[model samples]
Target: MPYAATTGRSIAAVTLIAAAVLPLTGCHHGGGSRPGAPTRPSAAPRPPAPGDRTACTPEMLRFHARGVRHPAHRMLLTVTNYSDRPCDFAAQPYPLLRLGPGQRAVTPAIGPSDPGTVITLAPDATAYAAVTTAADGASGRGERISQFGVALAPHTAPGQVGLDSGPPVRVNPRTARVTYWQSRREAALKW
Candidate 1:
């Protein structure tokens, strides 16, 4: 019975020491708080600025010029069907070419004079439109302007007007247009 009591006391003493040391081990010993302790106030993330084109893509490439010469300026715009299912595309309003990033170039409030231009493509298929300019340039001859961007069809695969894979074409600012001698079909899918 004495040996059993001694063994019990030893075990109890060891358990008490272990319990006390375990808690102390967790206590921080440094003069300053632990390293990498998250004390810095979490930085408030800044919101994106208005009219920022951060989400722009190659398929949205588009530009239009019209004068008394041609009532409807011919536009070769690329369109993509992103979904697995086929999609039928109708004419979208001629996107106005803005000079700078902040300006609102295209207004959605204006209705199209004619909207029967529908083009259908199979799933994952990309198509191009030879669209006429919606804006009437009857007042004066607007010089040919070069504008390009990604296609903006909702839920559709992104498409581009110019080929981004090839060497960037240098455009003459004075000419106000970039000439691509390639075929229309070739130009549409290049980007």
Candidate 2:
């Protein structure tokens, strides 16, 4: 091919690429309004920003504990969002569990940690955690626990709640387990 033809093809290619990319450059498609402009609502709801995720404070949640009759050794603890705004919470794998009010040793998370897993609860929404107090025939220390505390964060005190019904819940903190905060009771129980 002649040099001129090669040069012409090169120019055409560059022009085509420039045309395609020009539209993408300096184009702001985010769901944000320009200053002093009439804001247009986004068609789809925007996900909460990272900064918007305030940890669910103790005051914002109400804890409840109840024995699972079907699952003899397991109990369900739920955290209901009593606040007016949405907030985020997660069991850093699992929350710090105290078998009893006087128990000083934080029951370590029993299973693998699911890092970065967080639950965002809206006002009035609830999250559940399935706690396995004592595994039958399992080794380690087993103690009868009628009351327990769930410290959502390291700095905060655990929110204690009594078993609403049934016998005293028995637990071996070393072998005990609590699932990460789940959106539903079924999910928590599955863990």
Candidate 3:
């Protein structure tokens, strides 16, 4: 009986070892299958299912503003998921604006809409928001905008990103509007 118990434990330990090793070996890591002795290909690792993924951290998300040439004056605010997992943005994220040398957070004239359709950003995937500096060609003649302030969470002060490093972008602030984040660039650019 004593021998049987020890054997059982040994078998379990070996099983755990094999479980770890087989995947590595099957991928041609274990001496190349004894010089091509009928080697079998290993399956590629599967990504975690949608439900198994976690929310994106501030570090995992990247923000960029691409200028759009139009009379209305617009920019595409892009948020990219750089992490290995998928993430969801349940509601529209508000952007904090900083302008001139003061670098104060000025709320844009536009407001974000409530939760729209759920958007899931896969790793390296991008979502877009439309930023309009001027609603019309003749409007906002006196408003000046320097840089947008990044905020990781709602109502949080200054995000990890540095938007003020670049040259200031002057625009008519009165008509400026930012649409809610959208899965498609077209949707964000609609307004």
Per-candidate TM equals 0.28, 0.64, 0.56
State the lDDT of candidate 1 residue by residue for 1-191, as single tens digits. 69999999999999999987765565555333444665545489655454322322333223222121222233344445454444343333222222223323322222332233444445455554333323343313333334433334444432324432333322222212211211234332222
Model 2 residue 128 CA deviation (Å) reads 0.7
Please give the lDDT score at residue 81 for candidate 1. Answer: 48
Question: Tens-digit lDDT track for model 3 on 42-87?
Answer: 7997767646645555778988775665523776678899888788
Give per-residue CA lDDT, model 2, range 80-152, as digits (tens). Answer: 8998889887435366788764556776554543434678889999988888877767634577778888887
Question: Would you list the C-alpha lDDT of every candidate in the order shown?
Answer: 0.37, 0.75, 0.62
TM-score of 3: 0.56
Worst 10 residues of 2 by lDDT: 26-35
Better of 2 and 3 by TM-score: 2
Q: Superposing all C-alpha atoms, what RMSD in Å does each candidate have to the true structure?
A: 13.2, 14.2, 11.7
Ranking by lDDT: 2, 3, 1
**Candidate 1 residue 149 C-alpha distance from true site, Å:** 2.7
Predicted model with the maximum TM-score: 2
lDDT of 1 at 24: 54
